[model samples]
Target: METNSKETLQADFDVFDISEEFGFLLEEPLTHLPDHYQVWLDLANNLIHLIESRKLRDLVDKMPVLSPDLLSDHRELRLAHLALGFISMGYVWQEGQHAPAEILPKALALPFWLVSRRLGLPPILTYADSVLANWKLKDPTGDMRIGNMDLIFSFPGGDTCRGFFIVSLLVEMAASPGIMGALEVMRAIKVSDLTGIKNGLIKVTQSLKKMKEKFKFMHNHVEPAAFHGKLRIFVSGWRDNPMLPRGVMYEGVSDEPILLSGGSAAQSSAIQCFDALLCIQHEEETGAFLTRMRDYMPPAHRQLIETLSVCPPLRDFILSCSNSDLCQAYNSCVSALVDLRNYHLNTVTKYVIIPGNHAQSVGCPFRGVGTALNTTGTGGSNLMVFLKSVRNTTQKALILERLS
Candidate 1:
């Protein structure tokens, strides 16, 4: 979708939606930056190019900032330093070159940074601190207490978290070898192979379990009391069949029982139980559902409904083979879903289309929907644009009729 105007762009940037807009702005060389920053800009561009080209060996050797010493520095330097480290390590990994035993420390640090803090690293640390502090204040002896009160604790700590981190690290390590190789590596790493690795894994799993229990408690207790009488809707999809079970239709039912067997019925039964729907397969189903929903939903609900309908493609490839029948079917479904969603969106006077999961692909029209949502988690931005368009069109029509 085209930006409404530069005014809208500025307003969007005023909030944190600039990241969403960043995806759009990246389509063109940023004319907004001053000429003086060209060196830094060029450096950043070259860094990305080298990383992408798998030619990081020469680049990393020359860059002191990417050295293992910098990577092991305090938390503040970790993110920037680790990103550079990953580019170097990724390059080495791509070339089928394992780091020397001495250099493996640096290689391990790269994935540790990626798993612990790459995306939202600083914020996660801050949040973890806040959570631990709150827990300590409430229950000093609780199991939720942060063991390393001074050192930044990984949020969602425990064995499962560790396992996930390990798996992610291994996966990134084996990305060049592809998924099967990654899985093989995961299987090869026995619990006894590394000291404290089992304990770390256990902590991750326990922490995850605790997190789930806490969420379940909060959701059951807090959410019902807070959002009582409101219709809650949960929408998700199944892109990979292997990720799901065999013999299951793509666009049919959810595997989760709360959502699958009784979610819709529960919503229908109780004033408190919210309506939920999941589009498991083709994007087209989401579009069709939104179009059908428009006739029944109020203006307030229409925005979120529209947003869900217009979500971008949720998966990269249906399978490894691009030319496979599954890929074709998946693409066709996504295309149809997007078209239907847009058609329904055009029918509305004020609506929002928030994107989820697959927010990258510009080919999908709904990618812009993520931008339109801004950061408020509210439909105001979209509603404002839609309402303005409708009002302008109405005024134009009245003027034309008068002239006629």
Candidate 2:
């Protein structure tokens, strides 16, 4: 009966032609998805089982390195890599451990890194660190507690807190469309197909603009007090019996911690990819301002962004070709980007600065808000100014002036 039931559970996967395009992780109501997506559903569920059982490490090392090209073509493959990374952290970060998480071998880490970026997923480490690895207790006197002239509140964080894993699911759900769109954009760029590139960038620009609009929900719709209260309940049993994250994790003595430097900086990298690809250079302090923000991203992604930044911008490459039509397209793309960044600036004000004022975690290492600048210091505008600088420099970028 046991074997039969287990077989029946996964048997559903075999008949359904599972593929990544189905958006497995983001989909709700597992039973509602067509048979074509069931393969990944099983895989995703299995990964969940592994984490919940505290057995992720047993097979995490055995997971294979998949081609990003292949993963890009198939969302299931990407989903597998994502689940594996999440599972590893669930175990390695462990319950009750405060030290650094064990090193995720470059072999295991690299595939996830590539797959995630291509899929429009931000760095997994940042997702885990901000949402999972952090914790704060509710206390009138607790440092993290938000108290004002009238109200005080707290959130789930640290050990037993499922905030990281739980909230990350939502973030991924929110971000998956953008990630897929970026992958399409990169594909268009590779062929130097101007039309495809224009469409792709437009798609992403709109999506990003939408993302900024959604930031309003963080403030206007639910707000913090009721938001945190309800969320804690949703994640209530996470530590007791292990639920959304799969299970409780224990650290292994032999595992040494690997630190990922980022909390806010990773958010910037997504935007930086546009500049790097466009070869739009920032002048002096303006450029310096953005460079400094790179520290907030995971070291691997920071390295990736730095490498891309030094490459000749797209306009420089196109100018060498002397293709006017393509140049115009490039200019349009940059304008769209500027519009997108303008939206981002407003989001920073809403999500980061406002929350920071209310005692939420923001600023500095964690760029949700400007910590030092939260008090109106010099560096806070590092992010705000960078966005403005990009917009201001648009006409000066490669061929944008002629178009303007």
**Could you tell me the C-alpha RMSD of candidate 1 in Å?**
26.5
TM-score, every prediction: 0.20, 0.42
User: Per-residue lDDT tens digits of candidate 2, residues 1-404?
Assistant: 67974464344223222112321132221122234433333433464355445455555555554444543243344344444444444434333122223355443556555655554443343332333222233443543211211101112222212332333333333333443444444555566766755665555556555544443333433343322322222212121121222322222211433222223322444566566666766878767656755654444445545655554445655666566666665666666667655765675565345644654342222212223233221123344555566677854674643431
**Which clashing pairs does model 1 show?**
158-203, 158-204, 159-201, 159-203, 159-204, 159-205, 160-204, 160-205, 284-337, 307-353
Q: Can you tell me which runs of candidate 2 are displaced by over 4 Å? A: 1-128, 131-192, 221-262, 265-269, 283-312, 320-328, 351-398
**What is the Cα root-mean-square deviation between model 2 and the actual structure?**
15.1
**Candidate 1 TM-score to native:** 0.20
Please state the error at residue 67 of candidate 2 in Å.
30
Per-residue lDDT of candidate 1, residues 1-404 (tens digit): 23653454445333311122121111111212234323222333354345335555554444332222323323323333323323322332333212211122233333333433433231112111111111111243443222311111121122322222222222122211211211121222332222222222232223223322322222222222111111111010111111111221211122321111101100110000001111223224332432432322222223333332343322222222233433333333333323322333442212222322223234323211232122212111133343333233322221111110
Candidate 1 local Cα displacement, residue 183, angstroms: 40
Q: Which candidate wins on TM-score? A: 2
